[model samples]
Target: MSAPKPIRSIVIVGGGTAGWMAAAALSRLVRTGVSVTLVESDAIATIGVGEATIPPIRNFNGLLGIDENDFLSKTQGTIKLGIDFIDWTREGHRYTHPFGEFGFDIEGVKFHHYWRKLYAEGKASWIEDYNLCATAQKLGRYTTPVADPASVLSRLTYAYQFDASLYAAYLRAYAEARGVVRTEGKVVDVLLRSEDGHVDAIALEGDRRITGELFIDCTGFRGLLIKGALKTGFESWKHWLQCDRAWAVPSANPGREITPYTRSTARRAGWQWRIPLQHRVGNGYVYCSDDISDDEAAATLMANLDGEPLRDPMLIRFEAGRRKLAWNRNVVALGLASGFVEPLESTSIHMIQTGVSKLMALLPDRDFSPVERDEYNRQTQIQMEQVRDFVILHYHANERTDGDLWRRVREMDIPETLQRKIDLFRNRGRFFRYDDELFADSSWIAVLLGQNVMPAGWDSLADAVDPALVRQRLDRIREVFRRAAEAMPRHEDWLARNCPAPTASVTRKTA
Candidate 1:
């Protein structure tokens, strides 16, 4: 048996979040005989409108040894406790998909079941009354969770809203300082090996050619190598998710308190997002072109801004699906090149981060074993599919009767995965997390109940105790959470005292 060849040079085609993220991960984790190189054109721009994110991003940064304060200061970032969903069920209805557990499980039963039992008896308050994240958000408060499990502060979980462009630059410095070479030019042609049709090298201007044993594709939407060269097809998800166009714009800070959450307001044909950053607020209207024109979308976005526009809305068109195989042959696709769900749940950047994480885990030798590639593709498919289900939930479980889009989605057929979850929750208030799904039970509960999908029955155990005792227990828990939330510092005050961005940055050189 011959020894497998070692991979030496890795070429990342394109830049922005995905390419730089790949560079950053390889620069930190790659073992013997491997080096990372990234090629991006100075003329090309990034789809940096992906500003909101989930909590795992903090872990991603921590793994790279990124100090929290430094990251926030550099990226114009802000804390996010959850997403504020408005008018999702119907007009004038609002709910928060918070990041933490609700009222800590009581005894052996989930808290929601107990709460549900009370609510059925007209003894419970709104769902938010049990969540610290929701309470803190309502009061404009923010605090990092403490380490002690017994403490009220320990339940808090968080994410962030940031300027994606600055984040890419921040990571660029991190990767470059670790010896990842950067080439500045666009690929004029992709050369494939005659024997296997594998990408061998890419041609740039000035007649220069750069070759590598492995290639990473981060060229947003273009799929320059994976789909364009390898002919790996895409699995279109437009049927389930029909909203395909977005108009993104930045707005001046409204000189008001920055809420510690992202807000998504349902529109006639789609939804508009509000992401508050330290320096500005990012706003966008994502709508289906079948129902609204580009000009109408842009005008809708502009009209909805809370402050003056920073720049004209940038209209971006996208399809909702992923590549058939994120890793094909010698090339692996990352970020938008691999696939995209609309920025509805703010999964864009997280998708890029997860792809890079999976790539590092499946680092292959020069032989590029098909087994590893298939596993990587399989996991990627599951992750994308899981997220697709969650995103579709927001659209499918709606009660809005004002628009045809809503009506269509409400009646649309969803994946069996989501259907099963929804069915379980509806049948008996049982929400279970399967296959390490991204959205936890609390998240599902928040959405299901907020959308008015009440369970027919809760866990039978809720009846084990006297109903009056259950109400008293829930009341005590809710009161403690409310007091704890009220005591936390305001998000703005916390930012100013802890990690405010400097008014000016020259080169962003770390001391």
Candidate 2:
């Protein structure tokens, strides 16, 4: 006769970006008469390596009622217009995978259709010319989008490059201010209910047993709660992902105009990531363990840095996989505890946000309904698998013959979903987004074309359009993007004037 009451006590095990993000989002929705406590240890170290993010992160921040400028300043963040992929297509080729739409659709047909017609007639320009973010990134320019539909600024989307540890600290203050409790100690044991085998509470090092109606595991690759307690299985994707070990380090900024994008350069055995923050640059070499030794990987990472290393390159070992079930019994796993896909596409933080969001949508009661867990796991499976395929496309679809790593990846068998997408595009540059997945059409186009996967034929409808008119329209689109990008302020100059990070007493200075 009455609506079901939500769970009252929520316990978050572990802390870092994942733990605090769950706390912050929950604090907003479950403010009154609900207890949310987080348990973390000073001795346990956080990976703190996911510095770059994709565009969806902005939406998560907006939903949390966070100001972009404040968040940027606190995290010492920099704008990320897109990612610059170097040597991906071949030994000497490069490409830009920008954030927004390529151009406007005309007469109920995609804009790329018309451009394809012009290409066939030998009159069209490069695809990058029509992309605002690519042009702006090339010139180190950045500007916020406007609400006006008629302007090219309307579609400009961007993300951020920040220090992951600082972001966790910032969110900690926010969550604590909103009444989320913080417990400092290591978890010694997990207690499960005898009746349903659900986790009831965790025992801390001080012999303190804290009980809760629900639990969230943010324990990085260890999977203490999801795997250790509930025994969720893992599905490895190493064959497609290839790279499993990474050596990360921070270096002095090269001071080369501070471009508004992340750069991923293909290497002899793996790839190097260059993420430019406001004060310094974050660099890492991710390589396959079988192809190269840890010593070789570390040296390769250190030798390629643009500036002197701030510290020794930290070694991180990971398996490219996903938890078979993200939610089991009364415990839900967030962040690395759930699973990992390498940081190639910057999907780490985004995955954590999505997990918390989906939990809130299907927020359960003390009764622990199996139906909700089933649906949550189903959705999570779809999201992760889709992302996995996208990441694999970058490695398996390459034209590089550089070394064993590249050669093996190029010849590896790919998932059917990605293979179908590649085949469709290769036959004709046609890509369709399914069920509003994470990456959109423009993302696929960028990587496909960037890796030299050209369409063998154009759409038949594209041929119906007049060639002269197509060329004229295509030229206009490129010019509009060029003019819009030129009007923007330089990325470094804009940050200094609008959202500069504060200088800290410890760690590093905010440039």
Candidate 3:
């Protein structure tokens, strides 16, 4: 019946996007007499290929009070309207999963429902036509969205393509400036308490002992604290997500106009990602090792570069899964330390951001109640599963005949949750969002339709609207999006005029 004591000292192990982000976000606690210390070794390198992101990142930046323009300039950032998936459904086919919503809803019926009816009647264009982000991406345009509800430009949403290392450095400076202590050393050992089996302190290589009330693990895939010390178990999803290896390399810019989107081109054995930053382009080939050799994967990546290779390809090995308990005992895991779904959708950093957000929301006291721990675990598992299913959809719904990888994934048994969504959409375009999943209805609609998964019938409610009126409205919306995109500045021009990196040279090219 005693009052719970508040946590005082907080220690973050490892430093990269995850550790620095946790430090920066928790820096506010310094004013409340809670010490935040981050320990990292300068010798360790991070997997910095997480250059693309979704729109929620803007909210994360806003939470940190980061100036958009300044952050872009410092991080060599470029706008990412969404991902352009090439040859995913089938060879020679393409589609975009844009960040913003599709056409406006009509009379309480979803816009896609009306579009489906119109499409079936040969009166509608591609779903991307009604999306301002997709239109702007196609036109190579860039601009911040407006607040006007009536304007087509107001519907635009975007994320960033930037150097992950530069972003971590930027956040490190921010955290350090806000009084978060940074210790330079590698952790040699983790000491645990006797009675409760909780992490008591970390022993550094140089005979340093750092003690804290709460510990955060950001040690990449090593899971140094959460799994290494606490013995937390991992639940692997490798069978469902089989691409466990990647060959990453950077390439020189081709001097063409920078695009406002990320490009994911499906390969014979896997897929390749192209993320353009202001200074250079980030490229990677993620594939299953069983289907392709490391050398072959690297060769494929090098052969497809738009420009000269900047460095030798780096091979990365990983499994697609999450720790069974993200919050085990008093230790919380973030980023790769917690789990890793492939960066196909660029959810790595977003996962770290959400972990930090959830930690803040359910911050615990010295008692470390199981109630709080259980809730955090539940939320984390659900969110990870949702993302896993979304990523799986891209592979499962493919129509490619290039390699066994595609065929196997397509024929594989996906999670029942994903199956339910696909089944519902296939029936009558009846898709539903569960547990407030990360990808919204618009996202699902885009991938479902883009990959040629047509619904058998339109929503019953869509039948109430007049077909002619729906077609007219759809035509008007498409034209408005096109004209609005045309009015925006070129992506390169916008970067030059607003937040170009010091080393970036702007080049104008006809779209």
Highest lDDT model number = 3
Q: What is the TM-score of each candidate against the true structure?
A: 0.97, 0.97, 0.99
Cα lDDT tens digits for candidate 2, 89-149 = 7888889999998887776677777776676667887788888999999988888788898
Which residue segments of model 3 deviate by more than 4 Å?
none
Q: What is the lDDT of residue 260 in candidate 3?
A: 92
For model 3, residues 325-404, the per-residue Cα lDDT tens digits are 99999999999999999999999999999999999999999999999899999999999999999999999999898899
lDDT digits (tens) for residues 11-41 of candidate 1 = 9999998888788888864445578889999
| Pairs in steric clash, model 1 | none
Score each candidate by Cα lDDT.
Answer: 0.88, 0.88, 0.93
The backbone clash count of each candidate, in order, is 0, 0, 0
Lowest-sum lDDT 10-residue window in model 3: 502-511
Choose the strongest candidate by TM-score.
Answer: 3
What is the Cα-based lDDT of residue 345 in candidate 1?
82
